[model samples]
Target: MTGLGTLDAWVGRTIGVGWLPTRRDLDAYQLRCLNETIGKARVESPFYRSLAGWPETSHLDELKDIDRFPLTTADDLARGDPSLIALPLRDAVRLVTIPTSGTSGRQKRLFFTEADIEATVAYFEHGMATLVRPGSCVAIAFPAERPDSVGDLLMRGLDRMGAIPVALPVDGPVEALVAALRELQPAAIAGMPVTLGAAARCMAADGGPPLRIETALVSADSVSPSFRTALAVIWGTEVFEHWGMTETGYGGALGCDAHDGLHVRETDLHIEIVDADTGRVLPDGSEGEIVITTLRRRGLPLLRYRTGDSGSIAESPCRCGSVLRRLRLAGRIGEPVALGDGKRLRPEVIDDAIFAVTGVIDFLVEFRSGRHMVVGLVTSDPRTVDEVRSVLRSHPAIGPALRAAGIDIAVEIAVDPPPPPCRKRRVLGVEHVA
Candidate 1:
């Protein structure tokens, strides 16, 4: 196994493309990657061997037919044997398995080889290169478990770059985290938007330390622009949003220096925007589900995996000079709140409205049906209900859409808040509360 320092140097030297390759260059690279990936998948993975047919040596264009290759879904893994690893079980240097949080009913078991871990760390290094400079102290507020988890991997990467990393675990009491932040006084912070928002509130109440956070990296859930603005005001820093799934290693896209949208890592992965209803590809700038093909994954590879995210693409080159496609993620496709009308409401819109209400501590929105939604605001403010109603009524899209859907507005402002000490407080569109 390579030392962390050596791996960091190699990543810093050759991970990301300095300049965006031309269309011809990208095409050639894609074809080469496709050939190599298909060859390996066919030879090593039994799941793919039965699904993906052999490719001809001369006709490379046949790879464009995605239908020829069977789609691999989370369900496929649920039914298969766990020992069906692509590489020999003994040769696997390091094995790390983390059951997903189970956002869906079924939990996904993720297997990572030592090489997969290294690749993930390298990806983070490449992504951070756009924002992090040497010697920057990064305060990580994600799940920091012992041995090796995603959070541990991030800490290792930051250390390799000579940046101080403060791992503030989100599992324990919030007061403990507050104390740790005061002691560490990091230059940058990274975590889910909800965690960062709570930390920002703590900082606001305590008149936080004098240190200024230069950049804030947010991930793990959909982030609203209002939440980002609030966090920036509290921390006196810029928030950089990142998008990735547990299955796709760690992160697939990063917010460029422009900060307008996420620049897809074209060199490491291929991205496709397809209509959520039909799998047909959509033109650039159209909102659709995201499908990704991993170019360099050796362990638990994914081919055209449905990400279930709704976002659009920015066709032009980013102001940062990277030609990689930039994505504007709206929200999860299956989770969108359906109005009584044909139209649907994005979760971000509700987040904006919820944050606008003053004296609201924590809240959850439940769509009882297309016609009604219950808003639970955790605040003692007597005027919280009226304020929420006023804001919802004023919004042109929200009000009109709800009216068209025949949704009778039901607002419940609770004086007693729900149990705290959880990672995220706001659970939007929750069908049931455990």
Candidate 2:
């Protein structure tokens, strides 16, 4: 049986107690797991074998050599053949299908074995230890009945730690979820920040029972710091952020107790930040596209896969004592825009400038183009809508990025009633007809 207590203790000790692995030790283990998984893929999967010259050695000549492998992108998998299905169907126990947000593509089905599900549950057990008390409960806003879904896996993890887990069917109304939460009064809540934020709004409006939630885990979307603070204020608890995708078996990385950058599951995966255009690896602290290699994945293993999230890696020692590094995922990959004056705009940089404004309690950025770029913002304050626009207009990057993109952009602000929920699209893009 997987030992939840032991893993939880080790992780806690790693962070604060004592005796964590050294950098050298972690590297050796990563190399070993990488080699083992690669050997399996080459032997059992035609997709890997079809590579013109798959590395045959047991060891990587240089870590940078990983970039030489072709990136497994969304288009590649959407058009993939049966041969790319790495594991035998007999051994595969679960399947997860995700639709591409691209303008066009079929849903991609990911296969996993029982071991994969177990691995995910084990990670959650340790990760959730930061929030779950042995006798308490976890309120999940996602579906838990689906076979091997993230909610189900989390329930198993919490169960192993002697905590109860409850959820309303995902498709069910949020009001039902709010009522159940009021009844269960779980010690921790897990859901998208927006979903929780929306639920908090419903509770505030309906004057419901106190949830008594101690902490929360927010995932499945990007949120601004102000937005997170707003969510926390409604629920009266700290929100711990999580960043992951279905491709990573929904268990890539999570924030530690310190609530700094997220600590990647470096033991089971290797992460890299690469220049989006050149695909060259960037040094720590440089913002770029995120590339991931699964060290322990069995069915449908991914190597040098582009995750399409914009983020940076920080190797500096964290506030926590653990040796593991952190990833600062800013948001999803952005589109290119040419400024009316011929300077290319940096969308993420604009994101920084807009979010940095003092009164932007929580906001959504909307862009519709014409001769110039027109920017629309939704903010928390309904009374000072124009003032919010003034703050953004005075930003250093917004004007320059807009002017450089050669698009005639205008800034509009609206004072909305509350924080944006998970269902709120942070960025809404419209094609420029001109």
Candidate 3:
């Protein structure tokens, strides 16, 4: 068996097997569950039943046959139609309302049963075990005020592993979180990328004893290369990236020790990469939009749900030798702002360069009419402000994108504390004004 706490055994246990499952066993189990989920959705979900062009009760002969079903989008859920629920509203223990700008202010409400929530907790327990030792303290920096929130579920999982789980306010002041972590001296920390990076920079400036943090689980947003390097270099901790959304019950793929890619929670989700323009499924190692299908979810089973995130299935086998497939995320899709010269500016490109500068905490990018851009930066040290402006001006990606688009950029720096982390970070593009 492979070391480094690979999820192979946990997967076997999830699929009700005593040992690790071979490729054939995993596929067979997925096919069976897929058929069951389809059958259940057909009967219990009004959305599935009313959806056109799909067989009412037909069982998928193979996993590839899923292409026959039509795709589900955020708009479908954003409609707030009760037909999306696979079970009665009363049965749902937790209801998550996600307000999306793309939805014209209509919120996407998700229903989760007690069983569904517990499944996520199970994934968290086994997944987090790889990062933290038993009896170690874990500072959960995500939201945990409500029951069954990602943080609460994480806390429950860490508790199961005999690890002490401490909740740090994700929306509160970064200084407070840094102080709490310093006092707690946690073994592992889990939260969003920007939040963790901001706090790490603050800790580095404090100039105290090195934090004993062993691992960091950064999730709820894309993890930048610079952010990972910052955490590793500053705290001497392994940074693990996690990819998931409320649609996937908040637990999807997670990075193993190899750090090459994230090992997916295949027991619950069957992820596929598909072309954004056409709904065609792409081959392995091909970057495209992420599509998800729930395997065991009962309250609200999703079928071919388009996540609008760009990623690919890793072509190379994991060094950890886990039987599960790995997902290599390429961040969110459609994030590029078109410039006047038909060139495009990628927020991630700017993010990577901005965060590479030391003492930089968090930054916001505002693009106007493809002609001008304002980079609002919050830095721990005022001295780093000049360094950031120089870096952005000289960055290869930023310069070309700006010149080709004929866009002028102004760097604005502030030493004041940054606001709480937003739901998702991206370029704030304004309409091109005449």
Candidate 4:
């Protein structure tokens, strides 16, 4: 695996990386890849045929101005445009569907070719190396029983590394998950944060079977500070975070031992942080919506695809020894509420306010007209609501922030199984009240 062979191993060679691109080499490679994708889309994909902001085929300099490209939103994919698909259905090896948060909205569909799946597996082969040593058994809690499921691809990668993966998809109750945990004491586990958080709570409450797990890889949602602390204390393991979406064909970025930020898959994708409203690319370290361009994707080559999740790029290099940049994720852009005084209250603020109180499973800070907040909660006991209210009231800034803006909050804790697993419950969300 020397020189070009190593390069071939890195990219699997449809795009052909002759060498590991550095600073300007990175830009050149991305530009070359982007142009090729654009050219292909113009011919095959119906969507990019009429799609705007394509730079002149020969002029690579124009690629620097990516703002010229149209922003692909969740709505774009939801509409089920035939033109978005670059290849015929026969060419695809896998397809994934993502349902949006709202009750009634179009589900996003993603198509992956064999090469795409290989790319993902290769990424996991390298990514999981950060957490588990070779031959270590890991309880893969992700739903991988299906074809090309994240779990399957990860398992394939683990096989390459000699890791024994207990491929368990999170499909049942927390008790079932706990039962599996008791049976197979795998060294590590990776899955959705909400699902895993619920399992953690269940195990902690029941004093359930303690496994020899060393790490929990939580992805999709940002882990609240209190929840992370609880998992660390109860499970006695380091909690590593992952950031990815359906459009990313699953895994996009992963954290290193330093845990400063998630190392971006820079060679395969180009990520940008832009002001949500203006579509202006923010400087590194400035929080904004994450937009990505698939530098080497063949299926649905999304140009400047706007992912509604909010986060920023690290301004400095990571101690992880990789030159690839990292992303610092905040909550979803839609999760924050704007006040009459132009003040914005992030959901994290309320998370600290409520989770500060004990016996709380989860909560949703829904906002109504007149800046009113309905605190929907799931708690263990009678003391939960009052304790939650007390914590918010005790917060010097929360009280003043709400009072100055004429906002009122009402708390409601459910006695029954509120809605679903506590993890699916939002700590802060906005709902329009007519």
Best by TM-score: 3
lDDT of 1 at 239: 79
TM-score (C-alpha) between model 3 and the true structure? 0.94
Per-residue C-alpha lDDT of model 1 across residues 131-213, encoded as one tens digit per residue: 66768888898776765666787788787777888888576544466677778878888887766665565555554464467
Off by over 4 Å in 2: 1-19, 53-58, 61-65, 169-174, 205-211, 335-426, 432-434
Per-model C-alpha lDDT, please? Answer: 0.66, 0.67, 0.83, 0.71
Better of 1 and 4 by lDDT: 4
**For every model shown, what is its TM-score relative to the native structure?**
0.82, 0.79, 0.94, 0.83
> Cα deviation of 299 in candidate 2 (Å)?
2.0
- The TM-score obtained by model 2 is 0.79
Ranking by lDDT: 3, 4, 2, 1
Shift of residue 219 alpha carbon in model 4, Å: 0.6
Candidate 3 lDDT over 1-434, as tens digits, reads 12334477888877877888777778988999999999999888989888888865468999998888889999899885647888778999998998775728888889899899989998998888888788999999888888898889999998997899999867767778888888999889998887888888878887766686888888954677898899988888788888899999999998888888888899999988999999899999999999999999988899999998889999877898887889998877776666755566666778889889987877888887657778788765777767887787788878877777677777777446455483556667754211
Output the better candidate (2/3) by TM-score.
3
List the RMSD of every prediction in angstroms: 5.2, 5.4, 2.4, 4.4
Looking at model 1, the pairs that clash are 341-405, 371-407
> Which residue runs does candidate 4 get wrong by more than 4 Å?
1-21, 56-59, 101-104, 208-212, 337-344, 362-382, 396-413, 418-424, 427-429, 432-434
- Could you give candidate 4's per-residue lDDT for residues 407-432 as a string of tens digits? 88788875444423423345444541
**Model 4 clash pairs?**
47-83
Give the true-structure RMSD of model 2: 5.4
